[model samples]
Target: MLVQETLEFDTPGRGSTDITRRVTEVVRAAGMTTGLCNVFLQHTSASLMLCENADPDVRRDLEAFMQRLVPDGDPLFVHTTEGPDDMPAHVRSILTGNSLNVPISDGRLALGTWQGIYLWEHRTSRQARRVTLTIHGE
Candidate 1:
């Protein structure tokens, strides 16, 4: 069986926002004992990842690094219809990813102790983003 759900989020920059708990909630609600959970961001300027959740600094550092790598404005992009962050956001999402696959066992996500699922928003302002979660298993 496959179960799917959509979630919304607000972000401030091209960075990661932890969504581990929400994913877990969906997994539990799905009542799947064994399967694969696939999470996808339905946008061009956002992505997903599994990263360290134990430390806030980790996320901060990642955000900082991404900001430095992409910055806010660039002279080469032609798709600047959304502002300076428009192209950079897309680039950041491309650099990161758009989806994630995680293991599920005994109706729970098999994540590491310090690991967490994140929604990497690659926009400069707070925007409503949608995340689609799909579970395939018994």
Candidate 2:
């Protein structure tokens, strides 16, 4: 059987925001055991990842690195209809990721002790984003 759910969030920039608890909730509700859980982000400017959840500095530094790597505004990009941040956002997403797969056991996500799921928003504004979660198992 497979179960699915959608999660929404408002983001500020290209950084990680923990969503592990939400995924766990969906996994428990699905009642799936020993299966695969896939989490996908619906937008191109955003992505998903599993990262260290215990440290806020990690996220901050990651955001800083991305900003430096993809700094806003480039005359080379023609798809800047939304502004300089638009093209940079797409690049950031490509560099990061868009989905994640995790193991499930006893109706719970089997994440590492310090790991957590995150939605890596690459946009500059606090726009609403959607994430799709799918759980497949017996």
Query: Cα deviation of 81 in candidate 2 (Å)?
Result: 0.7
In order of appearance, the predictions have TM-scores of 0.93, 0.93
Candidate 1, residue 7: CA error in Å?
Answer: 1.7
Q: Model 2 — TM-score against the truth?
A: 0.93
Model 1 steric clash pairs: none
Worst 10 contiguous positions by lDDT, candidate 2: 9-18
The residue ranges of model 2 lying beyond 4 angstroms of the native Cα positions read none
Candidate 2 C-alpha lDDT tens digits along 1-138:
988899888876556778888888889889877899999999998878788889888888888888888888977788998889999899988888899999998778989899999998888778788999888997
- Per-model clash counts, in order, read 0, 0
| TM-score for candidate 1, residues paired by index | 0.93
Task: Predict model 2's lDDT versus the native.
Answer: 0.86
lDDT of 1 by residue, 44-101 (tens): 9888889998888998898899888988777878889999999988998899899999
